[model samples]
Target: MSQTILITGGAGFIGSNFIPYFMTAHPDYKIVNLDKLTYAGNLDNLKEVENNPNYTFVKGDICDETLVNALFDKYDFTGVIHFAAESHVDNSITGPRPFINTNLLGTFNLLEAARTHWFDAPNTP
Candidate 1:
């Protein structure tokens, strides 16, 4: 049986670097990558795994509860590698709403979806 996982902010610098490494390292696991494709995120960084059988890419925001819940229900993810965040200090100082939404609210949404799907409805097939 293969294990499925959700990886957020996968188009960003660090997450993009990790995705290929993780896929190569864990051939038995399937990765469902979720990224909002922010200015800091570049799809070119993930070109290596574009055709990998065990990899999937989704363009979406982490703050979207409906989308997050749908992904959880669809993938039955066993784990999450959350790397999404608004990391620019200057931008945060200038405009903090996006940072708060993506970092805080987005994390909450993901956690809630995971908890609901993995714990509250463990019997879902």
Candidate 2:
């Protein structure tokens, strides 16, 4: 059976590169890309997989728990590859809130969603 995977920050440089390669390697897997399209992310970078039937692009923030939870429920994602972050060092120093929110809280939201969807109980393997 094919699995659906959530790929965060997929329009960014590294995630964009990884998605196409991963798709080629795992053709049966469906990829849902969630990206906020921040300055570091570009949709054009992901054009290679834009037409692929198994590929989907969703423009949104990872910090939004409602959206993240909705996606988990809708897609029944089997896995998540997280790459979203506020990565500019200069910007992070000048304005740290976005970085903390996205890098820390955003990651927490994804993890929480995954845990809720994938596990039957807390700390159960």
Model 2 TM-score, 2 decimals: 0.94
C-alpha lDDT of all candidate models, in order: 0.93, 0.94
Candidate 2 lDDT by residue in tens digits, 54-110: 999999999999999999989989899999999887888789999899999999999
Judge candidate 2 at residue 76 and give its lDDT. Answer: 86
89: Cα error in model 2, Å: 1.7
Range of the 10 consecutive residues with the lowest summed lDDT in candidate 1? 116-125
- Displacement of the residue 28 alpha carbon in candidate 1, Å: 1.2
Clash pairs (backbone) in predicted model 2: none
In order of listing, the candidates' clash counts read: 0, 0
Candidate 2: worst-modelled 10 consecutive residues by lDDT: 116-125
Query: All candidates' TM-scores?
Result: 0.95, 0.94
Q: Per-residue lDDT of 1-58 in model 1, one digit per residue for the tens?
A: 7799999999999999999999989989999999999898999999999999899999
